[model samples]
Target chain A: MTNATQLPVTLGLRLLRGPAGAVLVMATIFVVATLAFFAINGREAVSLFQEMVMGAFGDSYSFSETLVKTAPILLTALAVALPARLGLISVGGEGQLYLGALFGTGAVLAAVDQPGWILMPLMLAGAMAGGALWGVIPGLLKTRLGVNETISTLLLNYVGILLVSFVVHGPWKNPNSLGWPATIEFPAGAIMPQFFDTRVHMGLVFGIVAAIILHILVTRSRWGLGLQVSRSNPRVGATAGISYERNVLIVMAVGGLLAGLAGIAEASVIQNRLQDGLASGYGMTGFLVAWLAGQHFLRIIPLSVLMGGLLASADSLQLYAQLPKASADILQALLFIIVLAVASLWGRRRDI
Target chain B: MEYFATELLTLLFAALRSATPVLAVVLGEAMTQRSGVINLGVEGQMLLGAMTGFAVASVTGDPWLGVMAACFAGIALSMVHAILVLGCGANQIASGVAVLILGGGLSAYYGTPFVGDKIDTLGNLNHTFVSDIPLLGQFLGPITPTVLITLLAIPAISIFLFRTRTGLRWRSTGESQDITRNLGHNPVHYQLAAIAFGGLMSGFAGAALAVDYTANWVEGMTAGRGLVAVGLVIVARWNPWYALPAALLFGASEALNLKLQSWGVNISPYLLATLPYMIPLSVLMLSYRGLRASGGGMPAGLSVVFQSAR
Candidate 1:
C-alpha cells in the first residue's frame, strides 16, 4: 500500500523534473490566453468553452466524428514523426499525401472491375508507392546533392498539389458532374468498409495497429536502437559500421507510407474521390500533432485524438460563437508556439 | 517580328514588376541568413504585413503609412521569433516553422474582416522627362516606385555588405560565432538586429505586393514566395547582388507564365503555373555539384544551430 501510494508522487516529481512540467504549464497558458481573447471580444468565455467541449465530446455523434478525424491525423503525424527520428525535417507530408491519393485513385480507376479484396490492397500499395517516391526525392537530394531537404520537400509539395489540380481539372473530371472538378467516385468494391452503425472505417484500426507496431519497433527493437544512435551522432554511428544513408532512405520511406495511408483513407473513405480540397492541410496539422506529442509514437495516438476533437469543435465555434473558421488555425498555431517556448526553456534549464 | 518585339517588351515590364516583391523578400532573408539565424517565417510575416498594410491604407488613406504599419507589424512578429530562437536557444528550424504558422493563422483570422475591401494603390512612375529618352526611357517608364526602390536596394545592399564596417561584423558573426565572440562582439545582438531588419524587409515586400502589385488583400496571398526567397538566397550564393538576377529570373518565369496563359496556348494553365517552382528546384539540383565543390558559399556557423555541440 505504501509503495503504490508513493509511486504516483515519485512519478509526478520525475515528470516535473523533465519536459512534461513545461508542457503542462504551456497547455494551461494556452487555454487561459484563448479564453482571454474571447473575453476581450465581449463574448461569454465560460459558455463558449462549455459549448466547445460539448461540441467535441458532448454526444456520441461528435465523439464518432472526432474518431473519424483522428485516423488521418494519426497516420500523417506518423509521417512527420518517423522522419524526425532521422534528423530530417520533412515538411512535405502534404505533398506526399496528395500523391498518395492521386495514385490510389488512378489504381482504382484502372481496375474498376476488380474484386474488393484485390482492388483495396492494390490501391493501398499504389498509394504507398507514390508517397514513398515523393518522400525519397528529398532523402536522395539531401544524401546525394547536399541540398537542404527542408526547402526541397516544401517546394515539391507545391509541385505535387499542382499535378493533382491539373489532372482533376483536365483529364479526370467526371463528365456527368456538371462542371465540378473531380474524379469519378469509387465503385462499391473500391470503397473501404465501415464499422457497424458508425462512420469509423478500417483506417482507424490501421492507425491504431500502426502506432502500436511503430512504438514497439522504435522503443524495443535493435533496429530502433541503431536508428537512435545514428540520429544522435551519425559520425559515431558510421564509425560503428552503421549505414547512415540506408537509414535515411528507409526512414523516409516509412514516413511516406504512413502519409500515403492517410491520403488513401481520406480519398476512398471520406471524400470518395480525389478533389481540390483533398490535401486539406492535414499534413500540416499532422506535423503539429507530432510536435505536440514530442515525436513519440505512442503519444501521437491520444494527442491526435485531442487535436482532432479540437478541430471538430472549431467548426461549431462558427455556429455557436460566430467566430471565423480560422479561429481554429489561430489556436493551433498559438499552442505550437507556446509549446516550443516551454520546451526551449526546459532545454536551457537542463543545460544548467 | 514587330509584334514579337512589343510582346517581349511588355513581358520585360511585367517581369520587373513581379520581381520587386521577391527581391524584397530575398534580400531580407539573405541578410538574415548571413547573420547565422535562419528565419522561415517570412511567408507569415509577409501575410500579416499585407493584411495590416491594406487595413491601414483603407483607414488612413495613406499608402506610405500603410507600408510603415506593415513594417511595424513584421517587426512585432519577428521579435517573437528572435526571442524564441536567440533568447531561449530554441531549434531555429522548429522556431521558424512556428513563427510561420503563428503569422499565417493570425493574418488569416484578422484578414477576414478586410476581405473584398479596396484601398488606393501606388501607381507606376511615368515621368515625362524620363520617358523622353530613347530605349532607356522605354525600359524605365513603366516601372513603379516600389520597383525602382527594390532595384536601388540591390546596389545599396551590396555596398553595405562589402564596404561597411558593421556589415563585416555581421558577416563574421555568421561565419563563426565563437570567433566573433572572441573578437569582443555580441553575436546575439547582431543576430537580433539582422532578424529585425529581415522582418522590416519582409513587411515592405508584403506592402509592395498589396499596394503596388495587387492593390488588394487576400488570404494567404504571399503563398510560398517567402520560401522561394529562402531558396533564392542559396542560389544567389548568399550575395545580395546575385539575388537581383535570381529574383528577376523567377519574376520573368512568372511573367511568361501569365503571358502564355493569356495568349490562348493549348497548354494547361496549371502546368504553366508550376514553371516558377519547378525552375528553382531544377536549378538547385543542377547546381548542387558545383555548389559542393566550391564549398557552396554557405557561412561556416550557419548550420551550427542543428549541431548538438555548443
Candidate 2:
C-alpha cells in the first residue's frame, strides 16, 4: 500500500512497487487479454462492446430489461454492503434471497385474487420480512453467540436453495403442468405494472429510491455512524457503550429487508411469478458487486447497472458466439475478481 | 413398515456414498484450521481438483493418475492462497475469495468438454463377508471405495495430529504464532504444509464426487460442499476425526431427501432437501454461541504476513 513514488522507479518494475500499481497492471492485462481473445477469434471487440452498451442501455426496451436485472443485485448488494460496514461478513444473502422469494411468492399465491393494492404491499412485505428473519440468524450468532458470520451465512445459502427447490418441486408444483418444476403463474393483476411502454417495471424505480434512502442511513444517520464505528473498531464502540449486539441485529435486519425486497422485485416485476429460477445467482453476484464497489450503498446503483449489463450481455454471447452462457459467466467473475483485487489494494491506501 | 425400513437402509447406503466429498474436504479444512489458517477457497480448490481429476482421468483412463492430478491441482491452487496470505500478508477472507474466483473460472474453462461426460469409476469395494453380519452388515452395507477410504482417513488423521511431534508443532502454530516462533519453528512453513495437506484432502473429495458420487463432472460440481466443510470444521471444534460423523450426518440428511424424492413424496422437496444444508448453518450458529467470546476457533495473527530477515 506504499505510495507509488515511495519506491525506486523502473519502468518494468513499477507494478511491483505499490499495491495500487499492481492492481492497475492486472486490470490492464485483463481488459487487454479479453479484447485480444475476441480479436483472435475473428470477432470485433469494439462491436461486442457496442452491443453490450446497447444491450445494457441502447434502446428503451433493453434499458428497461437492464433495470429488471439490476433490482435484485442492487438490494442484495446492500444486504452485503450494510453488514460489511459492521465488520460482519454476511455471505448468506443467497439464502436470504431464497427465503424471501419463497415467502413473497407464497404471499402472492395465498392472496392471488386480492386487489393489486393489497397484494402488492403484502408481497413486498413478505419478501422483506422473510429476508429480515433470515438475516437475524447470522447476526445473533455473530454478535451474541460469537459465531463466525462467514461460515454461518454461507451454510444458510445451501439451506435456502434446498428449501426453495423442495417447495418448487413438491407442493408449489403447478398442477396443470406435467412435471415442470415451477409455481403457478401470477394473474395479470398480480404482476407489477411497467413504468412506461418499456419493459422496466416499477421495481427498478423502487430499487433507485431504496438506494437513496440507504445512502442517507449509512452516511448521515446516528445508526449509520454507529455502524461505521462498529466496523472500524468494534471494541472501541463497545467500550463507548454502544450495544454491538443490538446494532448487529439492526444492521442485519435492514440488510435482510433490502435483500428480501429484491426478491419481491424479481417475483412481481421480472419473472411475474415464483419459479425455481427465482433465486438465480443474484445474491452471490450482489456480494461481488458490493465488494467491488467497496460496499458503498449509493455506489451499488451504477455498479449493479453495469453488472446488470454484463449479465444482460451474457444471453447474447450464448446466442451469437455459440458459447455456453457459462463463458460469459466466467468473464463476469473475472471482472469481479479484478475489481476486488484492485479495490482491496486501493482501500489499503484510502481511509474509509 | 417394510418399505420404510428398506428405504431407510437404501438411504443409509446412499448417505455413505454422498458423504465422501464432504468428509474429505472437512478433514482437510480441519487440518488447515488447526494450524490457524481458514481457507475459504475450499470450494474453489475442490472444483479445480475435481475438474482436473476428471479431465486427467478421462484423458489417461487411470483412476490413480486422476487422483494424483486432483491432489496436485488442489495443492497448486492452495499455494496461490499461501502466497497471498503468507507471502503478501493479504486478508485471509479476501485471498480465499480470490482463489475461489480463479478456481471456478479455471474449472469452467478446462471442464468444457468433460461436462456431463461419464467416466470409468473406481467402482465399489464392498467386503461381502464383513458386510453380511446382521445389523453390523447393514451399517457397512453401502461401502463405496471412497467411503472406505474416508473412514480410514478419520482415525489416521486423529493419530497423526495427536500422537506425533510434528503434529504438536502444527497445533502450536495454529494456537499461537509467537509460541511456535519462540520454539524456533517457522509458523509459515507449518501453515503452508497444513494448507498443502488440505489441498490434497479436498482434491480427493472433489475426485470422489466426479468418479463415485455422480460418475460425471458438472460445472461447479463440488457445489457448496467446500463451504459446508468449513462449517463442519468449526462445528467439530477443529477435530479431524469428528468430521467423519459430521459429514455422515449431513450425507444422511441428503440421502433422506433423495430417498423421499425417489418415492414420489408429496412434501415440499425444497424443505426436504434443506435438511442437510441446514445442519451446518445451525451447527455453526450453535457452536459460535457456545464458544462465546475468545475469538472462537480462528488462529491468532492468521492474516499477517511474515518476512524472515536474512
Candidate 3:
C-alpha cells in the first residue's frame, strides 16, 4: 500500500508540524465539532466540553475507567497494525475478538470446577485459538484462493458476531436467567487479575508488552525486515528467500491472537458473562487508531489511551447532559478526519 | 399443491421486500467502484440514512420527505469521502472507514430519540387487476414504491453504465488514470461524481429500509447489508444488472429467517440470521475463479489502492 513508505512522512509531520500545533489543531477542531453537534441538538452545550474531559480524568476512579476501556483498544490496534505492516488491511479484529470471548467462555464452562492455574491457561489458549482461526481463514483465502482479504474479513465479522449470539441465545443461555440471552457469570478463578483494587486489569499490561515487542520485531529485527521486503514487492522478496505466504499467515494469526486476548479480557473482567453486543465497536476504534498512528506500534499506545478517555467521557456526557452515547464516536471520527486532511494537505504542499 | 404455490409466491414477495435496501446500495456501489473509488463506509452511510429517514418521516409524517432527507445524508457523507480521498489524497480505505465511523456515530447519536418510534410506512400498490390473478399475481401484488424504483434502478443503472458514454469514461478511470487523462477528461471529476452517486443510492437504501420496508426505526437496522452489497457488487463483477439476482438471493435468505421466527422453528434465530451472510460468502468463494476468468476483474485502481499503504 502507498502508506508503507510513510514513516519518513510521519516523522516529518511530527517534527515540522510541531507537537503543540498538532494538539491545538485537535483541541480546536474537537471543541468546535462537539459544541456545534450539541448546539444543533438543542442541548445547553455550555461547559459540556470541560465536563467531557473531567468525565475521563476527573479523579482516580474516572481515570481507571479510561484505562479499562484502553486495554481492548490497544490490543486490537496492534492486531490491525501487524497485518497493516504486511500491507494487508484486515478489518476482522472485531470478529476475532468475539471468537476469543466465545472460545474463552467455552473453556471456562467446560472446566467450571478447575482451579485458576489450570483454568487460566486453558481459557487463554482456547481464546487465542478461536481468534487465530478467524484470522487464518482470511489469510489462507487471500494466499491460496486469491480472494480479497478486506471483503472476506469484513463479511466474517457479521458471522463471528452472530456465532456468539447464536450460542448465547440458544445452547449457552444461562437457564437461571429466564430467557435473558447470556451465559452464566464467570467463576472467580476465570476472571482476569485486576491491579490496585481497580477495574484496570492485566489486559493493559498484555497490550503494552505486546506493543513493545511488536515495535522491536517490526522495526529492529531481521524477520521484520523480511515483512517489509515482502510488503513492498512480494516477487522480489520471494527471490530473496522470503516466503510472502508464510509471513502473511504469521502476521494474520498473531494479529488475531492479540485481538482474541482483548475479547476474553472484556468478557471475564468487564461483563463477567458472555453475552450479545460484547465489544461492539472496539475493533473499528482500534482500526482507526492504527491508521491514525500511521501503523506505528508504539504510537498506537497513546492514541488508544486518548481514544479510551474520549469514550469514557462520552458515558459521562450521556448521563449528565442526556447526550446520546454515540457522541464520542462522532468526535473520534471527526478527529481522525482532521488529522488525515491536515497530514495529506501538509504532504501535498511539500510536494508542490 | 395450490396452497404450497401460494406459500412460495408469498416467500418470493417477501424476498424482494428484504432485498430493497441492499439492492439500492449495490447499484450505487457498482458505479462507485467502476469509477475507481471504493466506499466501504456504505454501512455507516446507510445507517445515517435510515436514522434520518425514520426521524424525518416520523416528524413530518411523509415517507417521501424521509427518502429525500436520507439521500441527501448519504450524498453529504460521500462528499466527505471524496474530499479526503481525492482532494487531500488521503487513503481511500482509511477515509472510507473514518466516514463509516462518522456516519455510524452521527446516526446513532441522532437516532437515539427515534428509537422505538413508528411511522406509517410507504405502502404497497395493490392493483385489483394484479390481485385478482393467480399465485404469481398475488406475488406481484403489494409492490411498494421503493421496490419499484429499485427494480427500475437495476436496468436504469445497467443502461447508464453499459450504454452511456459517461459510464464508459467512469469505468475508464478505474482502469487507468493515464488512459482517462489521454481521453481528454480529468479522472478526478469522474471519481468525485461516482462517489456522490454511490452516496445518493446508499441514502435511498437507508430510506427504503426504514420508511419503505420496515416502516419503523431501529438502531443499526441495516446490519451488514451495506457490506453485503459491497461483496455482492464484486460478485456481480461490477455490473449493476447482476445485482437484481443478488438482491433477490439476499431477500430470500432474509425472508426465510423472518418466516422461521414466525413459525417458531427449532433453529436458532441467530443461526438463521447467519444464513444470509453465509450464502453470499459461499457464492463468493465458489465464484471467485470462474468470475475472475470471465474478465470483469476488480477495478485496476482498487487493487493498487489496497496495495499502496497511503
List, residue by residue over A89-145, the lDDT tens digit for candidate 2: 777778888788888888888998898899888887888889998899877776666
Top candidate (lDDT) = 3
Better of 2 and 3 by lDDT: 3
| Order of candidate numbers by TM-score, starting with the best | 1, 3, 2
Model 3 clash pairs?
A1-B307, A1-B308, A1-B309, A2-B308, A2-B309, A2-B310, A3-B309, A3-B310
Every candidate's lDDT: 0.84, 0.76, 0.88
Under CAPRI classification, how is model 2 graded?
acceptable
How well does model 3 score by local distance difference test? 0.88
TM-score of each: 0.95, 0.86, 0.95
lDDT (tens digit, per residue) of candidate 1 on B1-310: 9777877888888888998888998998889889898888888888888889988988899888898999888888898789889888877877788788878888888888888888887766577677778766776777777898888988888898889988888999999888779889899989999999889989889988987789899988887888888878888888988898888777888998999999899999989988888887777776666787887778777766522211
For residues B1-310, what per-residue lDDT tens digits would candidate 3 score against the true structure? Answer: 9888788879988998899899999999989998888898888889999999999999998889999999999999988899999999998888888898898888887888888877877776676677677646667778889999988888788788778999789888998988999999999999999999999999999999999888877877888899888888877878777888877778899899999899999888888999888888777776676654664577888768643522
Question: DockQ scores for all the models shown?
Answer: 0.55, 0.39, 0.62
Q: Model 1 chain A, poorest ten-residue lDDT window?
A: A320-329
Chain B alone: TM-score in each candidate? 0.95, 0.90, 0.94
Candidate 2 segments exceeding 4 Å error:
A1-26, A33-64, A232-241, A343-352, B1-14, B127-142, B163-165, B259-266, B293-298, B301-310
